[model samples]
Target: MNFDLFWLFRSLPAVILGLTIHELAHAYTAFKLGDMTAKNEGRLTLNPLKHIDPLGFILIVIAGFGWAKPVSFNPEHLKNKHRDEILISLAGPISNFALAFFLLLCARGLFVLPYFHYTATGIEIINLLVSWAVINFGLFFFNLIPIPPLDGSHIYTTFLQKTNPRLFQLVYTYGTWGLLLIILIQVNTKIQILPIMPLIKAITNYCITLLHFT
Candidate 1:
């Protein structure tokens, strides 16, 4: 199995930043909603080490997508358990979208610098900015996949729990395993059951167009 270590190296900053902010958003949102579990557990900090999972980080380096340690929160402390949980889960992905937009805006501003194209450092900065923006965009979309343990699952459950109990239970029961199986299949077969890559590509392309990045 050959992997491009240099590509991974370049992507490291984006991965760390994206994952760190994602978890922090969850922790912060939970705290805002009266759940101090994540805050008390020392997960409210912006430190990447506190949020990153070793296996997840390694997978990101080798594969282009992975998750971070989920911020733990107690629903009992929340004002409205179901609604708050959905809010907390939604925070992570929304934070990624915000980060992506900010990064792309910065990249756009940087690209307009008079000597940006001529200087090696400026070019590198632009590349990193674009890379970071795209990575965050991908993360934002990936987390929205409605599978168990993913933020989307909470969203689906929140809206459907009252309307469709049986379906929610079925997905909750087998979602994680199904997600893993799909990941494995995608890695080995290069066929996507979920089309995550295409979605990511579309997002990146949109960002590029929006930023007018040459």
Candidate 2:
């Protein structure tokens, strides 16, 4: 919430890493599924410059909902068109979850290391890593709300297609509203009612529990 230089400075690395991984997951998933759209556009690598969306990045830091420039994917190239497309789309959020968990475990290790003789730098790195975990996990969970333009929507879409095609279309078409509602609930209200906040709290608590009370 703090927009001071210190917060912005520390948050920059986390934003870059978060956004980079978010896009890379999609590109890599598509590439693995036989689509070269993302790779051809040079989005498969970890170089943050390639995926940065200037406006999105700025809004993301401010409003906490910015996305990276989307990686191109032609679902037609996938062997199982519908299934693989859903997988490719779902990959981004899944990767964020994985990264957040990895960072959490890493932070726990750093947190305990100081008691065993780690230096100040080690603790500082741990702080940064914890920030990364919190940010990544929040983003991951929030983005998977089954709204249009979000990975969860694609995942949910695949399932809906099998049940009721018309309903699926309606949901997908109205996804913008769903997304907007998520933003409003989580951002505007002083009392947080969104699912994401609780999940983040549980994850953070788990990290602390893992390290033990020293």
Candidate 3:
């Protein structure tokens, strides 16, 4: 593990922002759908400390995988249960993609200057925006995996009505077992079945292209 202080310091801000906003979107959308649990807990804000999942954040820096403290929601509070659940569950990953798109636009539009002055620091700005874009892209793709306790699992439950819910129920019940199994498999397999690295690279390349990189 290359534990360089400088790299960690630079990566810190974007990781914090990425995790915070992704969770905030979950809270906000759920609240709008009539769940006030997250709001009552004061999780609707952008404070990274509130959303930081310590182990998850650490893994994010070390292995590029991270998650935040999940925002609570009372599904019973929603008027339209099915539609509302789908929307709320979809909000988290969707928000990360939105963030990626916004970062890509800013990187391409405002930072790259073939016009009005400031050519010297363009590389710095490009790096920052590219970093921001990659972080969000990773979050977006990773969270969309349909595994137990992930946002994508919630999404799948909402959408895939025909699947054996009991199977996922078992996964949720034995969540610690499931997590341990996942980690062990990841270590031994040496090939991630659902690796998001390719998707992350694709998003980065798209960003570079948007910024007119040849």
Best by lDDT: 1
lDDT preference between candidates 2 and 3, better one = 2
Against the unseen true structure, what C-alpha lDDT does each candidate score?
0.86, 0.79, 0.76
Q: How do the residues 1-214 of candidate 3 rate in per-residue lDDT, one tens digit apiece?
A: 3456776777778778888888899899998888999999999998888899898877767655556888888878999877888788779889988888888887777654575226656777767777878878888887777775777777666544436777656766675456546655664567676667888998788767766754
Prediction 3 global C-alpha lDDT? 0.76
Q: What TM-score does structure 1 among the candidates reach?
A: 0.90
Please give the ranking of all candidate structures by TM-score, highest first, separated by commas. Answer: 1, 2, 3
Give per-residue CA lDDT, model 1, range 1-214, as digits (tens): 3478887878888889999999999999999999888989899898899999999888777766578998999888989988899999999999999999899889889889898856999989988898888888888988988888799889768767768999878877788878878777776676878876788788888878877877
Q: Which candidate is the best by TM-score?
A: 1
TM-score of each: 0.90, 0.83, 0.82
Which ranges in model 3 have alpha carbons more than 4 Å from their true place? 1-4, 114-120, 158-166, 173-190, 210-214
What shift in Å separates residue 212 of candidate 3 from its native position after superposition? 4.3
TM-score of 2: 0.83
Instruction: Tally clashes: model 1.
Output: 0
lDDT of 1: 0.86
